[model samples]
Target: MLRTGEQYRDSIRDGRRVWINGERVQDITKHPMFKPMIDVRARIYDMAHDDATRDVMSYEENGERFSVGLKLPYTKDDWHAKRRATDTVLEDIGGVVTRVGDETAGEMWSLYDGQDILNEVDPRFSTNIRNHIHHVIKTDPFHVSANTDPKGDRSKRPQDQDPDMLLHVVKETDAGIIVRGAKYETAAAYANQAFTKPTIANWGNEAMSDYAVGFVCDFSSPNLRFIARTGFAGRAPARDYPLSNKFDEVETLVVYDNVLIPWENVLFYQHTKAATFIRATLHRYSAFAFVQRNLKLADMLIGAALWNVRQTGLEHQPAVQEKLATLACYREGINAHLTAAIADAEESPGGLLMPNQSLLMTGRVLACSQLHHMMHIARELCGGQICITPDVASFEDPEAGPWLDKFYTLNENWASEDRRKLLAYARDLLNSDYAGHRLTFQLFAQSPPFAHLAAVYRNFDWNEALRFTHKSAGLSDQVWGDKR
Candidate 1:
């Protein structure tokens, strides 16, 4: 059943221990650092019921309504609906938000795809993943992901180093497994639950280890401490840092101190094979939503750059147009990949339709790799005034206001207020501290550059290229023989 915004807000206020900026947060939903994002997330939940967006964001099935974003994708139409739903959220919120339920829900779907591997380990474990997937659809919880751990001591195994460095199953009981460690998760403080799993670890000779565990953790579970990073919101005026103040999804280093995972919530446990399988394909389905955020970000870059150029009549210049075109190319490159990925959707082993992995993974690389250059081009186009422009306070001052207005105003068509607002937006988007953090987030959020290329390698059809080259060079048929 669909949930209302208030229901979501009330769900996270379950007395979960949380700290941000070195102070204990009493109510995360009401905390200043978290309130803005929580409101956005709650708004997304409420959007399903809103008359204007109800049809677009939700669907009626069997006398019940379910979120379009959380629905299991089985066909091309499902993907398009999911995309439209995400686009609608970004438009409604006026900015990009990555960790909202839709982006992280697919991580569970990726786990669902690995049901066969889970069954190979233990059939019961496979059932756990399937149940969780359906539970998401039926309950429409605010799901999130927890993959990265504060892993320590690269040289030593989890045993040799502090075992708690990586989240591991410390002990077992009739109730469930007791886990202790930490995870770096975004939006965990306000979200309902997370698909908690291990980070990328090289599973050595051991078939079973404590670190090889994955579970769905409830935020209300005790012994879990959410230590969040300092947020970008409320640090300055929202008008000055528009996106940062409104859309910063506060990340938390969630510390699990013997947190109990009920038997039903455990998806996989004490099995390196299950952990390794999940590690390989964790983002198989989620990467589409993650990369889709880049598309919106690109639009923001283009809008900022184009507006700056148009304001000054610099858009007519040949060099300026070329720079704008470079931004456009980057935007369209992402758009083309997303468009074609859905057009050529492939079937997963688990009977779900997965995006064209090659295209999605490659598009992630292209969009992330070239983002800095695109930002720089946008920065160059916006010019130095973005940095040197006085704040709103200076423009509003009685004595200084006239002098500012006289120079800042281009004409009656463009007033000082409009120009200042645009420049402020451009500054925040291109040159602010928040801008740099966003760039870094995109780079490492899905993993480093090498891992992205690895996904591309794993999914790419290497044989096709090899086949074409082999025929072009007139290679002998025995080149690919079973034996040398």
Candidate 2:
């Protein structure tokens, strides 16, 4: 079922403990640091009910309306609808915000595809994942992902150092399993639940371990604390840092001190195969949305750069045009991957339609790996004015205002105020503290760069290339006989 903005707001007011800037946030819905993102999420919910957006944002099933973002995929049309819904939200919000529900919900779908691996541990585990997927659709709660434990020491085993360094099943009780550890999660402070899981890729020969655990963590449960990074909203004026003030999806280090995960919420446990399978295939479905965000980011870069050049009347320069063309290639490269991924969509092991794995994985690499260079190109196009611009307050000052206006105004059409606003926007998009954090966040958020390559390696058709090379070289059939 669908929820309204106010209902979504009231749901998260469950008195969950959240700390930021050394102060306990009294109301996340009202706090300056969190309220912006919280309102964005709320607006997303509201969009589903609005007359103009309802058709695009939700689907009807059995006489009940549900969020299109949470609906299980069955056909190519479903994916197109999901893409449109996400794009509509981005356009409506006027900026990119990744961790809002849709992008993270598909992580659960990946586990749902691994029911066979889950069944080896416990049949109930498979059942739990299926139930939770439907529960998300039925309840329409704001969900996020939890992976990447603090993992204190790389050299020492978790047992040697602090055992709680990695989140593990500390105790199994009749009521539930109590976990103790922390995870770096974006939007956890305001999100309703998380599909908590392991990040370990290699299990070696070991079988059962405490770290091999996955569950749905209810944020309101006791013994949970959300310690968020200080936000950019209240620290600076919105006029000076537009994107930062409205679009920062605050990251949190969530400490789970003996938190309980009931049997119904547990998706898997004590199974290395389940953990390994999840790590390898975690982004199979979710990467589509993640890479889609990069596409939107690319658009932002292109728009900012092109507008800067247009304002300066450098749009006709061959050199400037070439850089713009490069940005377009980057944007379209991502567009091609996303579009083809859907056109050549494949059915998951669980019978759900997912973006073609090879295309999607490679697209993620292209989008994320080249983002920094793309940002640099855009920065170059915007020139030096973005970084050297004076603050809005300085422009408004009695003594400095006239001098700043005289220097900043380019023509009658481009006034000093307009120039100042553009530079402020470009600075926030590429040079502010928020800009650096966003870059790093995109770099490692889904997984690290190496993991992106590893995914491509696993999904790409290496055998095809090998067979073609063997045929072209006229290798003997005996070479393949032994391998076959």
Candidate 3:
């Protein structure tokens, strides 16, 4: 049930069409732009087999070992094991990389919780979702998510303009359903499959439509193309941009031109109720992993800022200490939410244990909404040296090397080379092109800011607050009316 790194690499070499920088990538496993991320994913798979990590990364069921990330949750211990596995991977990799697998797999679990709604339309649709969840555990393939479509116009209906703007069921055949459209997905180029679905939340009074479709898209199928954004690995030396070179997860615009989805792969079809249920509870479990990434990012900010002050001997300043405390508060705020969510875990409608929804949703808002300001605080603490420092080439130059060394060296313990490396790291983490892209990616990746608030509104106990206020005000029983 578990795959090796080489086996995982070989599985994606199925001759799928992928384009980046105006060139067709023949081997994604060997290409410079994609190879770094592929290697990271491969390393994660290898960790499951390693003697030291096998216990933490995998679980035994019926004499077979399976990935802990893909296992269906049943108890609180299961969630703790999953969290440890993800944290171990992040520590092993030495940086944050979302969309690897565990973070996106839970999206399918959300749909699995809606089986009753799915059964309302057809029992087969519910059966398909259950089969796919087990299939993922049995096969251990790399999976991702597909939701956002390149909806061309907001004012015009899909029928009035280009119908293909939003992904719809173009034709249903005896063999399968052929779909034509595109979706902006991260890691889809290298991932094996995606849980494809719609982003529309409101269905009004309509009960069925072509856009209300969801399926498991096999990336190796024909008529599929992956157009990726240019990567940051080969563009510069790894010494100058450490994080960018090793951790940039390239995003792709995956185009589906008359692609076929067999009946077995279809999770739901022509049912707006299923689509509505999915969008409402999409991130219920996945948000735990997504917000966990922000926690790691917060650590990066704190590490860079604290080290900068230590090098300059400013750690003794009260003002500097206050800023460091602020960063700690942000980090612990996320920690509290994640910890309490698990402690107060609730059972899903499908009988699976999920993190407390209210805490998880509110945690997502706290982590994402305050990220920009946290980055700014860290940037200020690092000073202007991060942006004004010269490149590695300038430091190694014969004429400029001596002058740069004389100016950059602070003490015998802090040499010019180490100083240069630190500034370069700080710059890449907060000021470079990669930094900006990562910030925007986190801002809108899971959904938009407004959606985060809406999730919190729906999950929070508003009735509890109303009941307390009514009792404190000594309101009459008649005033309660049917509100209770």
* lDDT per residue as tens, model 2, 243-331: 99999999999999999999999999889999998899899999999999999999999999998998999999999999999999999
Clashing residue pair totals per candidate (backbone < 3 A): 0, 0, 0
The deviation in Å at residue 352 for candidate 3 is: 0.3
The deviation in Å at residue 460 for candidate 2 is 0.2
Model 2: lDDT to the true structure: 0.94
| Candidate 3 local lDDT, 1-484, one digit each (tens) | 9999999999999999999999999999999989999999999999999999999999998899999999898888998998899899999999999999898999999999999999999898899999999999999999999989998997777778898888999999998899988898999999999999997888789899899999999999999999999998888888999999999999999999999999899999989999999999999999999999999999999999999999999998999999999999999999999999999999999999999999999999999999999999999899999999989999999999999999999999999999998899999999999999999999999999999999999999998888899899998888878877
Better of 1 and 2 by TM-score: 2
RMSD of 2: 0.9
**What lDDT does the true structure give each of the candidates?**
0.91, 0.94, 0.93
Q: Which stretches of candidate 1 lie above 4 Å from their native place?
A: none
Clashing pairs in 1: none
Better of 1 and 3 by lDDT: 3
Q: Kindly give the stretch of ten consecutive residues in candidate 3 with the minimal lDDT sum.
A: 154-163
lDDT of 1 by residue, 263-351 (tens): 88999998898888887888888999999999999999999888888989999999999999999999999999999999999999889
